[model samples]
Target chain A: MITRTLFAGFGGQGVLLMGYVLSHGAMHKGLNVTYFPAYGAEMRGGTANCTVTLSEEKIASPVASNPDILVAMNFPSLLKFEPTVVKQGLVVLNSSLIEESPSRTDIDLLQVPTVELAREVGSERAGNMGHGGSSQGQGKVLRTQP
Target chain B: MPSEKMLMRGSNVVGEAAVRAGCRYYFGYPITPQNELPEYLSARMLDVGGTFIQGESEVASINMVLGASAAGGRVMTSSSSPGISLKQEGISYMAGMELPAVIINMMRGGPGLGNISASAADYYQATRGGGHGDYRTPVLAPAGCQELAELTFVAFDMADKYRSPVMLLGDGLMGQVMEPVIFPDFIDLKDLPKKDWILNGCEGREPRAIFSMLLGQGELYHHNLDLQKKYDQITAEEQRWETKNTDDADIIVVAYGTAARIAESAMNDLRAEGLAIGLFRPITLWPFPSTAFRELAQNGRKVAVFELCLGQMVEDVVLSVGERAEIYFYGVPGGVIPTPAEVADFLRSVAKGDGEVGRRIDV
Candidate 1:
C-alpha cells in the first residue's frame, strides 16, 4: 500500500531533511518515492513542509492532500495540517512547543514531546531525530535508536 | 544486478542529462527555482570538457545560445518566467535563423515578475512562439523527475533533428523535487550528423550566410512560409501523450506539466471511489496530442481541463474538441496548485454535473 507522509514545521526545523532522509531510505528499498518541498516564501522562515510518498507501484502525485501520516514540528503546523489528516491516520505532534492536543478523535494522535526528549538526552536540537525515530517506529521501519 | 539509482534533485538531474546528451556549451543567467540547474552544470560541464558561462543577463545568455548554435555547437540555456521573457528576443532570432538549440524553462508564477513558485502559467509562452515570429517551438512537458531527465536528453536530439529550438517545460516543483534517476551513458558527438552550415573559418568551401534579414520584398514572406511548413512537418511527426484508464472512463482529466501529475493522483483517488475518471496528459505541450482530444470527444467523455494558469491550455482543448464534447475548465493563477484531495473532490463534484467543479466554467 502507498503511504503518504507530510512533514510540516517552520524553516530550519529539518522538516525537509526529515522528508529527504525518509525518501532516500525508501528509494534504497527499491520502492517508488517522491520528495518535494512546498516551494513558496519558504526561505523566509514561515511554515515549511515537504511531502513524501512511498509505494510499491509508481507514485502518481508527489503532493499529498490527505496524508496518512502528518508530522507537525510546530504549533502552527499542527493547527494547519491537523484537519487534513485522513480518518484513523496518525498525527505526530511536537507537544513540547504545541501546548494543546488535536481535538480530532477519529485518528490516532501521538503528542511526542520531541524537544523535551532530545533535551533529556542533552541536545535539544536533536528534536528532529527524536521525531524521526518515532515516525520510523510508527511506519514499521525497523531501526535502532541513535 | 539492476543499475543503482541516484537520489537527485530535478534541476541537477536535468543538467546531468544534458551533459550526457552531448551538450558541449551551456549559457544561462541565474533564476530562482532553476538556479540549481545552471549552478550544477557550471562545474560539471568542465569535467566533461564542455564550456559553461553564467551570462550577465537572460538576454545575454540567450544571445550566447544563438551564437553557439550558429557555430554548430550543441548548446543550451535555462531561465524562469520573467527571465524567459527577456530571452524571447534571442529565441525568436534563433527560430528566424533556423538554428538548433535546447532551451529549458522551469516556469514560475507569471505575467510580470510574479513569484518563484511552481506554475504552468507560461504554457502559451512555451508552446506558442513567445518571440515575435510565425513559428511554433516544440515543447516537452515532464510530469516527474525521470521524465524530467529523459525529456531533456531527447530535447537535444529533437532540436538538432528539426533544426529548431526545443523547450523542456518544467515548474518550480519539478526543479526542486528529488527522485531516483539513473543517468544514461554519455552520447558520442561523432555519431551525430555533421553540421555543414556552421561558420568554421572558411577554408576551400563556399561562404555560407545564416542571416534572418531579408531585404527584398516577399523574401521574408516566403521564409515565413517555409518556417510554417517546417513547423507543420514537426507537428505531423511529433506528438506525445499518456492516457490512464481513459478507454472506459466517463470523464477525462486533461492536464500537462506539474498539473497533470496532481491530476493523476486525484484520478487514482476517484478511481478508489469507483468513479470512472481518467487522465489525459500531454507530454508535448505544443503539437499537443490533439488526436487524443478528438478521440476523447468521439468517445463522448466529458473533458475537464486543469491548469496552473488562468486557463491557457483550455483554449487548445476547445480548438481540438470543437463542440464534439463539452469542455470544462478549472485553473488557479499565480502558482496556486490544488492538492490531490481537493482535485478529487472537484472532479467528483463536476462528474455528477450537479454543481460546478471548483469554479468550473463551460466552454
Candidate 2:
C-alpha cells in the first residue's frame, strides 16, 4: 500500500519539516519512502509545501500530482490544494487558523486545532507539530510519533 | 547498524557520498533545488578536514575546481540550471585541459531562468559537452537516492580514471527528495592512486604544465584525436543501463533519471493490466548505453521516448534506434510534471493505436 501526504503552510510553519519527520520515520521502519519538496523560488512568507510518499514497495515517482491525504496548515494552502486530494481521501486542516469549512463531501475531514493545541502546550510555534500528530492518526503512516 | 543507516535528503546523500569517496575539495555557488548540496558540504567538508568554498559565482566555482583538480585533488562543484550555464566556460576549459573533476547538475526547467522544477532538458548540454570545443562529458543519471549515492562514487572514480570532467545529471526532484540510502563505506584517501600528470610541487622532477591551448600547427588536431581515443575507450567500456521486461515487449519506453522513475510507475501499472510495455533506462547518459538499446530494437519493435523536457534525450533515442524501429516522443516541458496515471493513459492510447492511419510513432 502507498500513502502520499502533502503538507502545506506558510514558510515558517514547519510544513517541510512535517513531511520530513514522517518520511524519516517511515524509512527507519524499512518501508519505501520519498519526501519531495518544492524547494525554491517561493516568495518570502509564501506557502511552503512538501509531499511525503510511503509504501511497502519501491516508490517510482517522487512528484506527487494527486495525494491520498492533504494536510493544509493555512487557508491559502487549503484553497490551493483541496482539489488535488483523491476521492475519499482525508483532508486535515488547522482549524484554529482556517475559519472556513472544507466544501468536499466525498472525503473524510479531520480539523486539527493546531494553534490552539500548541497554545495549550505553551507555544503556538509548535502548531505544525500538533498538526503532524493529528494527521498521523488518519493514515497511521508511522507506528510511533514522528 | 541502525546508527549507520540515516534517512538522508537526496542532496545530502550526494554530499555524504562525495565526502566518503575522498572528494576533499568542494567549490560551488548555491542554486535553488540544489542548494542543500552546497549547504551539506559546507559543514561536512570541514568534518572530513577538506576545504569548502562558496565561490563568488558559478564561473569562479568551476575555475576553483579546475585549479584543485589539476593539483590532483578530488574536487566537485554543483549548481542548478542557470548557474550551470554560467560555469560552462570553466567546464570546457577543464575538459580541454584533460582534468579530472566531478560536476553535479541538478537540472531545473530552463532555456533561460526556467522554473525551479525537475527537468531533463540539459541532456544535450551534459552529453554533447555543455561547453565549447570538441569534447564529451561523462554523464551519469541516477534514478533514485540509492543510485544517487552509488553513482556519485562511480562519477568520482570515472573522472579520476579517465582524467576528464564527469557530470552527474540529476533533476530538481532528485536533489530535493529525501529517501533511504545505504551508503558504502568511506574510501581511504591514502589508498587512492597517484596521478603522474598532476601540477603539484616539483622538487627534483621537471614541472608539468597543463593547458588546453595547443597553438602549434596540427597540435590541436592531434590533441583532439587523443581525446577522441579516450572517449572511444570510455564509450566501449562504460555503457550502462537497466532493462525491464523488454524481451517480449512491443513498445519499449526509453527514459532516464527523473522521467525513468515516472515511467517505471506507468510501466508497472500497465504490466499489471497485462500490457506488453517495457522500460529501458540509461544509468549512463553520455556513453548513451546504445549497445543493449540497439540489440533490444532488433527487427522493428516500437520505441517511445519520454523526457521531462521538450524532447532532448529523445534525439539520442532516435540515434540509437535508427531505422530498425519506429519511435514516439512524450514530454512535459517547463515544470509541468506528469503523473503516472497520465503516462499510463498515454501508453494505453499508444498501445491501442497500433496501426491506425495516424499512428503513435512520431519518427
Q: Can you write out model 2's per-residue Cα lDDT over B26-140, one digit (the tens) per residue?
A: 9999888898999999999889999999999999999999999999999999998899899899999998999999999999988898888888888888998888999999999
Report fnat in order of the candidates: 0.87, 0.76
**lDDT score for residue A48 of model 1:** 88
Compared with the true structure, what per-residue lDDT tens digits does model 2 show for residues A30-64?
Answer: 88998888865765687799988999988888876
Error of 1 at B252 (Å): 1.3
TM-scores of chain A, one for each prediction: 0.91, 0.93
lDDT of each: 0.87, 0.88
Off by more than 4 A, model 2? A144-146, B1-3, B354-362
Q: Give the TM-score of candidate 2.
A: 0.95
Q: In candidate 2, how many Å is residue A70 off?
A: 1.3
